[model samples]
Target: MSWFIYALKNYLNFSDRARRKEYWMFFLFYMIFVFVFAFLDTALGKANSMEEALDLEGLFSPIYAIAMLIPSIAVTVRRLHDTNRSGWWILISLVPVIGILVLVFFTVLNSDEGFNRFGRSPKAEPAF
Candidate 1:
């Protein structure tokens, strides 16, 4: 999907606004890939137990996760920016359950109309 590729291309860009569709589509595809890799690992006997599966102890899945880690954070930060929140808000997820719930609430919110401070809304059409 274009959205997934867009996120990957901007993998290190944490200073822009990302539309909700972009963020969610990347997330959807990322999870799908993780599952696919995990299945391959199990089929190849790289992961032999439920614990290993849960721990993602496999060649493909772990490698994929490592490769995508920065992109995931970047997109999440950009998603927060779209909502007009500071990227530092991502640290809120460090507080366990409440923090994660709060972060989810923030990410699911609609982008601020026009712009507050981060930049133009990703949902806005460019003027010609």
Candidate 2:
């Protein structure tokens, strides 16, 4: 819970480092929110067809994602910073088949052993 809020609090902050825990925890809560909204949209809307239900889901789904977009980008950049990589590395995700794999690899890699250009180790202290 605190992790989720911390991510939001720094929503626009792209500088500094973000620990793996901070990144993954925020994503966990974000996914939970998306699932809950999807469930509600489906159950309450009572659409007549699959298409209609999907439309309802689409209507509500974008809201959460849109709200979180900046924070998501900021955290991903910070996460790259933690790994001692330029935030521009995130653009690798634009590549075809291997793009997502490369991004995941970047995120999962251990943070730099010590400080680099970005900042000190996020693991040395809590992200918040």
Candidate 3:
């Protein structure tokens, strides 16, 4: 999906606001790809054991996480913006435990009815 491509291309870009379409598109691609790969990997029986399969999975995790970083941050910022909160609040995730949950809650929360400071609105269709 477009979001996946955008995320891969903008892996290092953490600024700017991302609309829901972009964020969800990337999420959709990620889930589908991960699931398909996992299913095939299992069917192939390439690794001798589950642990080996897990180790193999680990090798790609860094790349996958890197691919996901930009959209994650961008979307999170926009979500924060929706709540009339500064994007800087994303930094709160640096805290030990509670911070992670709080930040996740905010980013995963649906956007407000209208725009705040980020942009017009998330309702517009992306130019795919």
Candidate 4:
């Protein structure tokens, strides 16, 4: 829960590293909220059919998606940075199925030890 809020607070920050836990928790809550909003839209009669829902004719889900878009991209870029990759790697998602798969593979990788170029690893314990 705090992880999700942390991501939102950093919604526009793309120059730092993010822990895997931070990235995944934010998306987990993001998906949950999307489903909840979709359900609310349906119950409120904003969406009358599957096609309407899929098309984002509903009020809540689409607005939620729009609001989350920047934060999502920011966290993903930070996640890529944690793995010592350039944020521009996110452009690979445009390639096709393989592109998205490659991005996922990159994100799932452990954070680079210490740091390569993108500042310190988020996983590192603070020096006392």
Candidate 5:
């Protein structure tokens, strides 16, 4: 839970490194919220079709996603920084299935031990 908040607190911070736990935990909670909101939309809201269910009037998922967009991008960029890669690496996901798989591979890997161009290792910092 703290990890999720930490991610949000640094929602605009894309200029540093994010340890593996930070990146994954944020994503985990984000996906959980997305699922919960989708469930609420379907069970509590009126919608005759799938399109309507995703429309602005039907569910909280869209709103939640919009709210999370920046934090999500920030974390991903920082995760790439942790791997000693540029934030532009995120655009690799535009290639297709292969691109997304590559980005996932990079994000799941552990951070660089010391530092690169981005900043000091998040792992080297003391845990709060």
Candidate 6:
């Protein structure tokens, strides 16, 4: 779907809010490609040395970075939705180790009431 492609195009973008569906869908796409590439690399070529396989791992570096970034960004926005704060709160993680852990906890916490500041409540079910 275009959503998945859009996510990939913005792979390196850290800003801009993302809806839950967009995040999950992109993740689904990422996993599919990861499996495909890993399988193809292993099946088509024989890397006799550990170093050779290590080289293949390098090929995955950029994709891995995006895979990791998308979820982080999505979760941050969802967390902000819960607290009624803006997604910018994610920047708190830059504070230090403790901040990172706290943000993680906050993000994983339950979505807040009807709505706060980051638009409608994330938990609200859509009619569609």
Candidate 3 overall lDDT versus native? 0.62
- Candidate 4 lowest-lDDT run of ten: 119-128
Off by over 4 Å in 4: 125-128
Per-model clash counts, in order, read 0, 0, 0, 0, 0, 0
lDDT of 2 by residue, 15-109 (tens): 88888888888888987887766666666664444455445445565576678789989989998999999989989989996998999898998
Span of 10 residues, lowest total lDDT, candidate 2: 47-56
* Candidate 6 deviant stretches above 4 angstroms: 1-57, 67-71
lDDT of 5: 0.86
Predicted structure 5, TM vs. truth = 0.89
Task: Put down candidate 6 lDDT per residue, 5-26, tens digits, no spaces.
Answer: 6655655544443455655666
Per-prediction TM-score to the true structure, in the order listed: 0.93, 0.87, 0.58, 0.91, 0.89, 0.50
State the lDDT of candidate 3 residue by residue for 1-128, as single tens digits. Answer: 66667655655544445555666676678767655554555566654444544445543433555655666676666557765678889899999899999986776666666555666555554434
Q: Pick the candidate with the highest lDDT.
A: 1
Compared with the true structure, all predictions reach lDDT values of 0.89, 0.81, 0.62, 0.88, 0.86, 0.57
Measured on C-alpha atoms, candidate 6 has an lDDT of 0.57
Top candidate by TM-score: 1
Worst 10 residues of 6 by lDDT: 46-55
Candidate 3: give its CA RMSD in angstroms. Answer: 3.9
Could you list the CA RMSD of all candidates, in the order they appear?
2.3, 2.5, 3.9, 2.4, 2.2, 5.5
| Lowest-sum lDDT 10-residue window in model 3 | 53-62
The candidate with the higher TM-score, 2 or 4, is 4
